[model samples]
Target: MGAFSLEGYKPFMAMVTMHSILAVMNLLAKAAFQQGFSSLVFVVYRQSIATLALLPALFFLRGRSGVAGMSVSLRGFCLIFLAALFGGTGNKILHFLGLNLGNASLVSALSNLVPSTTFVMAASVGLENVQLRSLITWAKISGTLVCVGGIMILTFYKGPRILNSSNPYLNLGTALDSVHYRWVLAVGCLLVSTSCWSLLLILQVPICKYVDPLPQALWLCLLSSLQTAPIVFFLEPNLSAWKINTVTELWACLFAGIFGSAVCFYLQSWCISVRGPVYCAMFMPLYTLITVVLAAITLHEELHIGSLIGAVAIIGGLYIVLWGKAEDSKRERNHIVDASEITISIDDKEDNITGQPLLVNSTR
Candidate 1:
């Protein structure tokens, strides 16, 4: 039992650490935006550093089993580029901008939408099966709907202040007043980013079949840098925007690039390889909990009734989806086991029949 428990404990700890890292990254990103850094410039710098960080891995770990097995083609390259565009450039830029415009808690809460969106997108592409008759399928579908409903409520509804805290940066009243005006836009940005992330995950399902995860992630960072370069240059033409003028800005970029982007990819890839993607996904909501605590302490963020209510609904919906997935996986494994058992029984019966015939011949 101790050994059995340890297997679950180690992975849980890894997930906890990952979420902590992400929460810190969100805080740092928000701080950088508050320091007057342009979103595009930040994204450019983050992707550039992430690309560099992944460069060493590509060379040293070149001959790994998965990498050696896959053969990249022109089409595979295009898919990688598309993945970078949707997942890397689009997702990162929108997420940063959203974080810039919104509080960390809001951004974190919206992150739950990734799986829901992934489900919808996968089904759209005919990759996922949706059987209305199956309770598991209904759970997933209903869960997605509930999650979306929660998002709408959170985005549109802001009732009276449920919980207020003193913010060192600004008075609570002033901060809430400012956020009220930009609330819708910030939510829109978050939604778009979440959509891009979903598409990225969906795209990777196909891409992973043909490309290795390490090289895939490295190319994603590289291609994102390339894709974002012109956009950053056009939007932030001044050389001053490119310059890192403060220690805070430099630290934020390094954290986002090295840990948040590069290291995170490897950690998640490894976890998926070990425990599977569903296990990794089940830990996502932990990010929101960590972010909320960090934001309250560091940024003096407030909590609203709507935020709480929506968060609860979203979490409930997320659990439903996860439960459905777990059940589906169990069913699949059972199916394979049953089929193998039937095949073995048939083989055994055939062997007995042949042996009986040989015995009769020997007796004669």
Candidate 2:
């Protein structure tokens, strides 16, 4: 029972680990981009590396897959293709571009929007089983609002800097001294990028049910590589950008491929499969908190008091959401129990009535 209870948290742990890998990817990509590495080329290389890394998983998945027509048919291919476009290729491109425009901290903080946006999208389509009057629904809403609130505090209000220092990634963010107007476009890009990923999260629920998560991730990586390679080659103005010049660039690409793309993709699909998309996405706000901590440690940046407050809010909000989801699940189980008891009672009553009619006829 203890092990079983612990196993229940596997999805939670996977999501947390996924966000941690993402935080590292964000840091490495920023360092490379600041050193003049091509973000477009990085996307292509990242996807290619990820595809190659996933090849060995094919051996493990043999005979274990039971995908039906919805998974094997052309429609399944289309769904995976669209997922790759929205998440693998398109999401990475926009995310890196957003990093170029804003600091990683800021970009990551703003990305707390993903959970709320995904929630809305899922609810709109009845994927989340939302009702306006439901208390459980309100809990989800309140939690999202609080999480967004925390992220907003972190973004706009930079209180006094604590543990202030300098590091390799210190200068990665764009300075607003001459580029104030770019904020709008920067935010717009991040918003759209996040929306794309959010939609992909929702899409994966059905896709994962029909297809295995590992193969789905492999297809996402492979197709994304194919889709990205040609455009990058043609559009890239610098041939020199293709080669890895520094150790930073080399490790960044490798880690982003192996851990960021491969591991994260699999974990995400698995989490959504087990927990539902909104539950899976509710962990997104933690990305901002984890990124802040990582930035402080690696970049030697100051951890402001506001950041601590924001972190608290993010954690609190996630607790609320999980509580609501748990309550909802318990209620569902109780309803099933109640329904079965009612059925048994009706069966007993019918038996009693039939037995009485036989006794009366015999006595007569």
For residues 242-308, what per-residue lDDT tens digits would candidate 2 score against the true structure?
9899999999999999999988888987887777665775676678778877877776655566656
Q: Any runs in candidate 2 off by more than 4 Å, and if so which?
A: 1-9, 60-71, 142-156, 163-176, 179-185, 302-324, 343-364
TM-score of 2: 0.80
Listed in order, each prediction's TM-score against the native is: 0.87, 0.80
| Candidate 1 Cα errors over 4 Å, as ranges | 1-10, 61-71, 160-179, 343-364
* CA RMSD (A), model 2: 4.4
**In model 2, what lDDT does residue 15 have?**
92
Local distance difference test, per candidate?
Answer: 0.81, 0.75
> What is the clash count of model 2?
0
